[model samples]
Target: MKRYKKYITPYLSAFVIGPLMMLTEVAGEVMLPKFMSMIINNGVADRNLAYIGKMGALMVLTVLFMAVGGILGAYFSAKASISFTSDMRNDLFQKVQQFSFENIDGYSTGSLVTRLTNDVQQVQNVLMMGLRMALRAPGMFLGALIMAFMMNRQLAVIILIVIPLLLAAIILILKTAFPRFGEMQRRLDRLNSGIQESLTNVRVVKSFVREAHEIEKFSRLNRDLKESSLRALRIVITTMPVMMFAMNVTTLAVVWYGGNIIIAGKMPVGDLTAFTTYIVQILMSLMMLSMVFLQSSRASASMKRINEIFDTEIGLNDDNAKNKDKKVTEGRVEFKNVSFGYSGENGRKDLVLEGISFMAEPGQTIGIIGSTGSGKTSLVQLIPRLYDVTGGEVLVDGVNVKEYSLKHLREGVGMVLQKNVLFSGTIEENLRWGNEDAPMEDVIRFSESAQADPFVKTFKNGYGTEMGQGGVNVSGGQKQRLCIARALLKRPKILILDDSTSAVDTATEAKIRESLYHDLKDTTKIIIAQRISSVQEADQILVLEDGKIIGHGTHEELLKTCETYSEIYTTQIGNQSIGAGEEAAV
Candidate 1:
């Protein structure tokens, strides 16, 4: 919270002025009853119309002032609270932008979304309520109490006696409510996760005829959220009744005692009348205070969740680098005894990639072939400093990757991931995401090289055609090519294709590879592929198995020297050979 002092400091005027105006309302409210008492006992009792008229006018003026104060207080409070939360949300988003892949892996996507949107909103609403009532409640309560005691000490004692019991009930309920609210927030995350999964995969759910199954799963998550929310609210709601009951008993005691006092002439009727109004004001303020506590209990949970993001020390930083001023000038990549693992909150001692070492010369195409879960993506991600190596150093242009700033390092590497994604925009807009200032001629040239230019022109819009979210309007092969075209716009020093062309036909894949070699000869290339034919012509091939490189050499060099590479090549060729033989026999 102290870290957020900068955001709070600017709103100091609003914070102070809002409550001061509220105190003005309290001042008017407290005096109106006393004026009524004066009109009743001194003016009305003496049959003096002049005194009654004057005091009556004063009471109306008091109410007018109170109304103005309340309105001004509300205006300032809302202005301050809304601006505060808006700034806070902006900072939270910036923090998300700074997070490395490792920082993101520690939290679920749904949880992060919930924290940013729902949780931030919860805190904002509560803060608005706080700005309006936080100080006003106590001011009204204390002022009314002082007025009551002055009128009749005995009657005020009754309110004092009931106050402690009401406070105890509220404190007890709050103790239980805070944890329930926390549980409710966790359930909301689950509900969000369910909705995001179901909608994102709606086509699969429909194709598999599992719409009914998804509904059942979503219904369960929704029900859990409902139940937790009800439990938290139920506890908070119970506090109001307890407060009201205490207020009623105190009011009764005041009436019963004040009646005897009036009969004994120990208290005047006007003073007794004023005491009851003060009692309502005092008790009602107490009730308002309890509600604030209840709202705050929930807000506290959300604040904790938000602070978790703010408090996160960026996992990747250049402070410890031996050469902080180093920049990646060339694309020669070398991994020297590198190991990495997905670190969780608990910590990680074992690595997903162990003893990984390799070297790729500038402008060389290095083919990475591996089975599923063999860490092909993990290996290349290190070169871009997406994830830091745990055991050894990754060097680019003879400088350790940690030495280069993240912006400079990442700008030099262009990666088309395993899952090709295009945002919701025109095709040209999506392509320009890699290089916003790239010329139209460059865009067409890269698209032609990716073999996407022909189909793109088939659409009447050409490059201006609108792409749906995730490129759902386009076919898989089209999306892959578009992503490749987008990457080419970067003209990065190093380019990585992690199964990015798997959906394209072999001929198209061959054409794209040819363009990568001949059209972009100066750019170092790394291709991670499942098919041997895809990487057979690479400058060198590295075969990975169970988190280790089992073979490394040119295709011919590996076929003669490496058993792992031979078995993979033979199995594919042998299967195709038998199929060809059977066709000839028929």
Candidate 2:
């Protein structure tokens, strides 16, 4: 509700316009009854055609005014509703971006997308419909009742009896249907999640011959959504017929009671006719109110879902970090007693890294070799503050990473993930992602150094060739080289490659590495790889097992001193023996 109050000024203006439109509608309804009474009591009784013509024109003019008021009210109300929803969507998108990894992991991507798109749209529709009808229904109902009582108080009794029964039926329907609508929304989120997952992994699904299985799963979820929707509709469908039946019975009673009054000379024919019309008007208005209630019920459910995201406070805050006189520096990283676990409250039994310590000076390369799930990627992610250390601290350039502004920290580091992703754009456009203002010459230089220039030159448009979504148009090796080129464009102080060269051939990998070592002599490099040959030339190597560093030294030093490093090297490089002197020569 507080989130709703933020747009109060616009809503208040809409509320004010709604009543003015209602007043015009009431005036038009009021004039019809008076005109009918005049036709019977004055014009027809005295046979005065001129009086009937004059009253008929006045009624037509009143209707015209009502139409104009309705148009104006609709225009303003729609504008307010659309503007409010647009602002809310922007706010939600920005809020989602601000959330920490912990907060983001709590909600599925599909669920957040549904909340931003469909849920917000549902609420906006309710606001538009509620503004247009909420005011008019009550005004029409009460004004008609007042007019009916003034004409003949006895006939108005039928409306009093009928209105209460209608109200009870509406309340009963709402109580049953509102809960079902909320359940329907939850089911929709699940359906969206399934579709998103399947689409993202379409190739895997096809490779496994699971198309039929996926179709069946989607059908089951679709059926659940249909069932929930039908249940809510069933409840609402019961109310309309019951209300109409009650309205017809009330109409019959009014006619029967008014006939007796006419015969007893208690009411004129014209007044009885006007009285019946007002009774119909009141019942119709009540029906409109019931419809408004139904829409508001659905909107209420959607609002609760939207507010859940809005109410969540972002977990990461840099408010207390020093912001004064900060300067970006060449990357020199150190980790001291750093321990981390993915589980927040489940203790450190599932720790990814335990009591880890390491150091990498500027212009030197550190190789990280580990088995799967050994926290290699997790270790490098700490440098860029992707996730803050659960215990101890990671330092860059001798200062704690947490102490630096996120903007400066991220700008000084470049990373290429194991799973390479690319956006849809030309080759040049994608290369410019790392440094938006990189010169054409720098782009070509980095591409050639990464061994991506050959294939890029093969395209008719060369650097201007379009890549499909996620660079699906390119082969795996091409994507890897392009991602490396992107990172090189940043000219980062710290460059971390997490198995980025796996898809390329070893010869190309060696060439790229040789070029990188020569070009980036003043930059810090960290390489995570499965192949020992990929990292054997590094200044230092660290071998990890089960989230703990078990070996650290140069290749020759580790081969002589660390058993784990030797076993892995022998397993990958085979039993062919090479002297330590010969190994260093490569």
Candidate 3:
């Protein structure tokens, strides 16, 4: 709760102004009864019309003061609440961006979305209501009680008895409903997760004809959220009736006891009437305070949940060594006996890469071939320090990658992912993401090299053609080509193509590879592919099985020595084999 101090000043102003507003309300209420008493006992009883007119005008002036104070207090309090919540929303978003991948995995995408939107709204509502009611209700209640006691202590005694009963009712409601509201929020998160998951994979559900199954799963979560909310509402609903009943009983006691005293000549009729108004005022103020407590309990639950994300410490931090000296090499990559596994208490024991050792100098092409899930993508991800190795060190140039600033290490490596993703923009706009100040000549050259220029030119607007979300307007092969061209535009020292050519036909794939080798001879390349044709011309090839490297050599040497490479080569290219001319070039 104290973490929100930065946003508390405005709320504190609302608190201070609230008492002033309520002071005017009490003064107005008290003075109105006095005017009525004067009109009844002095003006009307003495047949004095002149005094009546003066008292009426004084009553109107007090009412005007109360109205002005009420409006000013409401305006400032609303302004403060809105400004506070806006700052909270911005801070929450910034904190979420700072979270590491591991920390983010603890929360589902939908749950985080709900916390940012719905949960924050709940806290905002409470802040506004607290300003309007919290201070005013207490001051009005106590002030009215003091006035009633001064008028006639006998009638005020009923208020003392009734106020405690209302307080007890409020406490009972909060104790039961507060915990239930927390559970309701958790259930809402689950419901949100179910909806998001179903929408993201709607294609899979339709293809498998499992729409009914998905609907049923979502319905179950929705029903649970509804039930939890209803249970909390039932507890809160008890508060209003119980509070009104206590107030009603106290009112009846005041009227009955005051009537007997007036008739017995123990009290005046004017004082008894004023006493009734004060008693009603006290009861109404208590009821408003009870309502504020009910809302505060629910908001307290939401605030705690939001604060949890704000308090999460970022796991990854820049090293002091990187700050002092942040130089990194172009394309010299090395993995020294590196082993890695996902970190958690119940995480898998089987390592993704076990004791893998490799080195590639500048201007060399390293080919990685493996079965699916053989850790090919995982290995290249370490060079840029996307995820640190669980054991051993990854080096660029001669320095440990962790010692270099992440910005310096990533700038030297350009990557094309296995799944092509494009932003919603024109072709020229998308290409500019790789190099902001890239010239048009450079864009055309890379596009031509990656075999994407021909198709791009065929479009009505060419470079200005608009791409839909995720490049949905383009074919898969075209998307892959554009991504490859984008990476090439960076003119990086090390280029990684992770099965990037899979969407294209064999002829196009071969032509692109030939052009890449000829044009990018000076750039170091790491190609991870399932096809033998993609990597046959490389300087060195690595064959991985499970998590270990089983072979490392040239295409001709590996075909003759390594069993896994020989088997893959036989299956892909067949027994026709490479001729003397082809073998020498490969």
For each candidate in turn, the TM-score is 0.96, 0.92, 0.87
What does candidate 3 score on TM?
A: 0.87
Name the regions of candidate 2 deviating beyond 4 angstroms.
Answer: 8-15, 324-327, 344-349, 575-586
Model 1 TM-score is 0.96
Off by over 4 Å in 3: 8-64, 268-274, 319-329, 346-350, 425-427, 439-445, 458-466, 518-522, 574-586
Error of 3 at 184 (Å): 1.4
For candidate 3, the 10 contiguous residues with the lowest summed lDDT are 315-324
Q: Rank the candidates by lDDT, best first.
A: 1, 2, 3
Candidate with maximal lDDT? 1
2 or 3, which is superior by TM-score?
2
Cα lDDT of model 3 by residue, 1-586, tens digit? 5777788764777657755665666667666776787677778778888998988888889899978877876776677778788889989998898776667877898889988988898888887777777667777777778878887887788888877877787888889888999999999999998998898678789999999999899989999999999998887778778877887788789999999998998887777777777777788887787777888888888888898898777655465445435554468788899997666667544578988898988879999999999999888878777677889889877778887776777787889988889999999889877897999999999999999999999999999999987788899899999999999998888899999999999789988888788888877899999898889889989999887899999999899889999999888776335554578788
Model 1 agreement with the true structure over 44-84: per-residue lDDT tens digits: 89999999999989888889999998999998888888888
Q: What's the true lDDT of residue 194 in model 3?
A: 92
Provide the lDDT at 343 for model 2: 44
Global lDDT of model 2: 0.86
- Top of the candidates by TM-score: 1
The best-first sequence of candidates by TM-score reads 1, 2, 3
